[model samples]
Target chain A: DTAVSQTPKYLVTQMGNDKSIKCEQNLGHDTMYWYKQDSKKFLKIMFSYNNKELIINETVPNRFSPKSPDKAHLNLHINSLELGDSAVYFCASSQQKTTTQETQYFGPGTRLLVL
Target chain B: DQQVKQNSPSLSVQEGRISILNCDYTNSMFDYFLWYKKYPAEGPTFLISISSIKDKNEDGRFTVFLNKSAKHLSLHIVPSQPGDSAVYFCAADDTGRRALTFGSGTRLQVQP
Candidate 1:
C-alpha cells in the first residue's frame, strides 16, 4: 500500500489558470507538508500542517494556498499559475508532531508544467 | 541565502566501491540531520539520520558521520550498486522547527 499518494502525476496547464493537487497519507501521520522542487533540484518547503492545524508557512507566493481538511489529507491550490511555477510538487507526511524523531514519507511527485 | 549546502552536484562511483557525499550547514540551532535519496520522478526517501549529540550513525551498508564542530556531515555507502544511483539530499531541523531545511542535492551514479 502507498503510504502517501498524490493525484495527477503530471499536470500541464496554461497561464492564469487555477489548479489543485491533492495528497493523502495512509500512514496515520499527524503532520503533512507541501514541498516544491525547482529545475535546479532545490527542494523547498512551502507549507506544513499538523493534525489539520497550520504550522509552518514559508515565504511562498500568496497565489499558492494549502488546505488540510483532515489529518490525512492536504491539498494545494494555485491561482493564476505562472510559467515560473513549473516544477515538481511533493507531499510528505511524518508520524509525530516533531521533526526530531519522525522520518518523513513522501509521495511520488506531481510534475506541474505551466505553459 | 541557503543554510544547508551540498558543494558537489554529482558523483560517479564504480560498483563494489565506496561513495561519499558531503554536506554542510550554517545553522547552530539544528539538532537533527538526515539524508534522503530520490529517484527521478519520485519524492525523496529517508535514508539515515544523526543527532547533534552523536558523531556517527550506521545502517547496514550506509553510514552517516556528523561533525558538530565544523557543522559538516557526510554519508558513506559501501559496496555501492547500480540501484544506488539517485539524488541525495541533506536536511536539518531544529528542536522547535517542524519543517526541515534542505540542501540543493547531490546526484550519485554507481556504475556496474
Candidate 2:
C-alpha cells in the first residue's frame, strides 16, 4: 500500500474552472503540507496544516484553498484556475517531533493543466 | 524572495565517478537540510539529510555535507550509476515551523 496517495494523477480543465485534489496519508503524521512545482522545477510550499489546523500559509493566491478534514486527509481546492496555476501539486506529511529530524513523506504528484 | 537556491540547473557525471550537487540558503534559522531525488511522473524521495550540529552524514553511496557558517549544503554520490539519474532537490527546515523551503531542482544525468 502506498504511504501517501493523491487522486487524479492528471487534471486538465479550462482556465475558469474550479478543481479539487484529494490527498491521504497512512503514515500517522500530524503535519500535512501542499507544494506546487512550476515549469521551472521550482518547488514552493503553498500551505501547511498541523492537526487539522492551518499552520503555514505562503504567498499563494487567494483562489487556492486547503482543507484538512482530519489528520489523515488534506484536500486542495483551486477556484477560477488560471494558466499560471498549471503545475504539479504534491502532498506531504510528517510526524510532529521535538526536533526537525522528522522526514516528510510525499505522495505521487497531481499534474494539473489549465487551458 | 527565495531563501534556498540551487545555482546549477543540471549536471552530468560519468558512471563510477562522483557526482556533487550544491545548494545555498540565505536563512540561518534553517537547522536541518535534506536532499530528495525525483524521477519523472513520481514524487520526490528522500535521499539523505544533514543536521546543523553535524558537518556530514553518509549512507551507503549518498553523503550530505553541511556548512552552517556559509549556509551551504551539498549532496555527494559515489560510484554513480545510470539509475541514479534524476532531479535532485535541496530542502531546508525552518527551525520553528513545519514547512520546508525547497530550492530549484538540479537534474543529474549519470552517463553509462
Candidate 3:
C-alpha cells in the first residue's frame, strides 16, 4: 500500500486556468507538506499543514492555496496558473511536528505543465 | 537566497567504488539533515540522516557525516552499486519550524 498518494500523475492545462492536486496519506501523519520542483530541479516548500492548521507558508504566491480536509489529506489548488508554474509538485507527510530526526515520506510527484 | 546548497550538479563513480556527495547550509537553526535518493518520475526516498548532536550515522553501506561548526554534511556510499545511480538531495530541518529546506540535487551516476 502507498503511504502517500497523489492523483493525476500528469496534468496539462492552459495558462490562466485553475487546477487542483489531491494528496492522501495512509500513515496517519499529523503534518503534511507541498513542495514544488522547477525545471532546474530546485525543490522549494510551498506550504505545510499540521493537524489541519496552516503551520508554514513559504514566499509562494497567494494564487496557490492548500486545504486540509483532515489530518490524512491535504490538497493544493492553484488559481490563474502561469507558465512558470509548470513543475513537479510533491506531497509529503511526517509523523510529528517537531522531531529532530523526523523523516518525511513523499508521494510520486504530480507533473503539471502549463501551456 | 538558497539556505541549503549542493554545489555539484552531477557526479560519476565506478561501481564498487566510494561515492561522496557534499552539502552546505547557511542557516544555523537547522538541527537535522537528511539525504534522499530520487529516481525518474518518482519521489525521493530517505537514504540516511544525522542529528545535530551526532557527527555520523550509518546504515548498511550508506553513511552520513554532519559538521555543525562548518555547517556542512556529506553522504558516503561505500561500494557504490548501479542501483545507487540517482538524483541525491540534501535537506535540512529548521528547529521548531518542522519544514525542510532542500538543496539543488546532485545526479550521481554509478557506472557498471
Each candidate's DockQ score against the native complex? Answer: 0.77, 0.75, 0.80
A1-115: candidate 2 lDDT, tens digit per residue: 8999999999999989999999999999998999999998888889999999998999889999999999999999999999999999999999987755778889999999999
CA-based DockQ, model 2: 0.75
Show pairs that collide, candidate 1: none
Clashes (N, CA, C under 3 Å) per candidate: 0, 0, 0
* Model 3, residue pairs in steric clash: none
Cα-based TM-score, every candidate: 0.97, 0.97, 0.97
Per-model CA lDDT versus the true structure? 0.93, 0.93, 0.94
Candidate 1 residue runs with Cα over 4 Å from true position: A98-100
The order by descending DockQ is: 3, 1, 2
What TM-score does chain A of each model score against the native chain A? 0.96, 0.97, 0.96
Tell me how far candidate 1 lies from the true structure as C-alpha RMSD in angstroms. Answer: 1.2
Clashes of 1: 0
Candidate 2 Cα misplacement greater than 4 A, ranges: none
Identify the candidate with maximal lDDT: 3
